[model samples]
Target: MKYDFIVVGHGLAGAILAETLRSRGSKVLVIDEPKENSASRVAAGLLNPVAGKRFAKSWLADAFIPAANAFYEALEARYGQQLFFHKPIYKIFSSIEEQNTWMAKSAGDNWGDYILATHTQSINQPGIDDPFGGIMIGRGGFLHVYALLDLLTEDLLKQELYLPERFDMDELQLTESGVKYKSIAADQLIFCEGYQVVHNPYFKWLPIQPTKGEVLEVQAEQNFSPECIYNKAVYVVPEGAGRFIIGATYDWRNPDEEPTPQGQEELSERFRQITSKQFKVTGHWAGIRPAVRDRRPLAGTHPKYKQLSVFNGMGSKGVLMAPYLAQRFAAALAGEEEVMPEIHIFRYLSLYYAYTDQQNQQP
Candidate 1:
């Protein structure tokens, strides 16, 4: 079989990349191991404009927010499935100082349209604490990640564009014009394997700090508002009916995606602090995020193997970053544009050189 591009891993990065390339009239074949636990699978799909304890605007929120919104909206229309939710994020202010800081920032045009409002009605309900009030961040919400992936999977399968198998690097042959995996040929091979990129020899020199995250699915005693994503020490987003997703715990040392008792307890305690509502823990999930050292996405083609490229390391912000970056990467592959410098693999060229030099020096 021959193709314009052979994409490995059907996770968020790979899915978006393949779709983008296909939209541009390229022949694409996706290779993936179907049951693998991936960050995208377990992600809450939150696309917040502001994050962290400091409540500062997220990186490139202005660019990412609009791009993601439009991209997901188009996909929803194309797929005929409701995927994107334009819910506001109500960030509960922990202190008067925090409130003051938000007041000052909201007064400026720094965040532009992303900041919907400085304050909202307190979530006046029992077991929920919010005396300090909260801020409403607009144009952000969750993407029904798995729903989109499954829709894409079905479409690809029907089109005979998907190969549901694990990709083995050993069987791959780098050819003069492209690459050959087994009997399949392609103009280029793009790796979007997420954290599994650690095992890929070609681009492992890039610093990818994979972090483990755990989240819980709980059935709250009361049905929370479906309009906004409420956050305090933990986030309790309405997942329809009486269920809410309470998560997530981040751990750098752990590599495996197996949920831990400690992770559950931590999330449970945090969930309790935010809301006094009784709930039953229905499900627990964990996955590794493909984080990078500089906290930016790692993209672009390989240094030596020009026909090989990567589109990984969007990390926890994959929902926000993937659409825009994938479009850029697909354009770069089509010889229409250049991958941005900061996220491009060239940023780590020195590391690749150092690694090759060390390899050549070895006996």
Candidate 2:
């Protein structure tokens, strides 16, 4: 098969990039291992601008949030499926000091885009306890990630552009003009293989941290409005029909995709802190996040191989950042714009050289 671009992986980054390239008139082929549990698929799809104990706005939240909203809204209009669920996040106050922190930053205020209110009574709902009151977070919600991926996958299949198979490194040949993998040829090859990029001989030198996170689906009866996502120690996000997705335990030591008893216990204990409501576990999911050392997406062409490129490592913010980064990467690939220095894969070229030197010395 012949194509303009060959993209490996069909996760969040790959799917988004495929759409972006197709929109820009590129004949792209996407090859993916369909059985792999992509990080995007297992994610709770939580979009919280003001997370963490300090409750300050997240890094680059100002830029990424609006871009995500615009991207999803546009995608929704075209696909006729509600992919982005825009809802307020009610972050439960842990102590008087936490409440005071919110008061200083935001006070029942639209004064800021992220923090809508501090110590609002709006959080007092059935099955939820808020004595100290928590801050209401705006521009916060979850994305129906699979809905977006499914639509994109179906479109790729319809166009005969979707290849379901493992991308073998041994079969790849680098040519003067492009890359040839078996019978497939393309002008450029971009790998969005998520954490699996660590296995790529060309790009393995980049520091891509893999984190295993697990989330549980629950059937709970709560009178609380499904419109708001509750964040205490753990987040309780409603999925309608009395089903809520509660998560997540971050396990860095064991970065494998398997739901563990320890992870389940940790999530359950933290959830109990949020409320005493009895709920039954319906499902458990685990995925490995393709995180970078500096917590930014990785994009750009290889230093040695100009036709080879990578777009991966969005980490916890993958869903929120993919659409924006995909556009930026597509533009960069087309020579219309340069990939942002922050995300450019060239940033790690020194490490690649150093690793090459070490390999040479070993022999």
Candidate 3:
């Protein structure tokens, strides 16, 4: 079999890239072995405009938000499935000082577009108490990641474009013309292997500070509406029908992809802080996010092998970042425009080579 591109890994990165390439009339073969603990599959799919302790508007939020909306809307129309939902995020303020900090930050010109001037009065939900702080953020919501992945997988299967198997690097050959797989040939091969990039022989030198995040699903009371996703120390995302997905504890030291008892306990404790109602833990899962040291996505082709490329390192923001970057990556692959210098793999080429040289020199 021949294809214009062979994409390894069918997670969010691979799926979005494959779809983008196929939409451009290119033949693409997606090879993947769905890890039981892959991040995308378990992602809460929260897209927040403001992030972190400072409540800073996400980097490139102005562009990324609109692009994300357009991309998901188009996907929903094409697949006849709802992939994105607009839900205002209710950020709870823990203290008066925190509320003051948010208000101070909101007054800035750069933050004006993303933050609201006044606190929200509508409590939306009754069980959770918020006394000191409240804010309704616009242009933030949840992507139905699981449903989107399922829809994409089904569509790819229907089109005979998906291969459900692990890609053995040993079987790959870099030919003079291009890369060769078992029997398939491609003009270019790209790896969207997510956090597993640490295992890629070619890209291992790229500094990926991967982090393990754990989340839990709890059965909530029937009164809470599934309209909004609540966020504070932990986020409570409504999963419909008296169930809410709560979680996320970031652990950089323990990078394993398995859920731990401590992680579950931490999450449950955080949940209890926000609500008095008793809830039962229905599910718990953990995944490794392919976070970079500088917290920006890595893209573009290998320095030594132009035919090989990578589109990984969207980190925690894969839901918001994948679509736009996938389009840009496709353009870069097609040689339509120069890849963004800041995010290109070439930015770290010298450091990577030096590291590899050091490894070779070591006993």
What does candidate 1's lDDT look like per residue over 1-363, in tens digits? 899999999989899889889989999999999964578988888888787776678887777877898888888898788898878887888778888887776666477666777654455755666777788777778888889899899999999999999898899999998999999999999999888888899988989987998989998776445668888777777789888887788798988989999999999998876776788999999989888999899889898898899999988788898888888888888888889887998999899999899889999
| Candidate 3 or 1, higher TM-score | 1
Q: What value does the lDDT take at residue 217 in candidate 3? A: 92
Evaluated with lDDT, which candidate comes out highest?
A: 1
Candidate lDDT scores, in order, read: 0.85, 0.85, 0.84
Better of 1 and 2 by lDDT: 1
Q: Tens digit of lDDT per residue, candidate 3, span 1-363?
A: 889999998888888889899989999999999676788888889898888677788887887888889889998998888878788787888778888888787767466545543563436367776776577777888888878888888888888888889999999999888899999899899999988889998888888877899999999776666767777799888878888888688999999988999999999988887777788999999998889988889998887887789999988798888888888889988989888876898889887889789989999
Candidate numbers sorted by TM-score from highest down: 1, 3, 2
The TM-score that candidate 1 achieves is 0.95
Q: Model 2: per-residue lDDT, tens digit, 79-158?
A: 98899999999899877777787777664434476767666443557777777788788889999887888888888899
By TM-score, is 2 or 3 better? 3
RMSD for each model, in Å, please? 1.7, 2.1, 1.8
The order of the candidates by lDDT, greatest first, is: 1, 2, 3
Clashes of 2: 0
Clash number for each model: 1, 0, 0
| Model 2 pairs in collision | none
Residue pairs with clashing backbones, model 1:
127-276
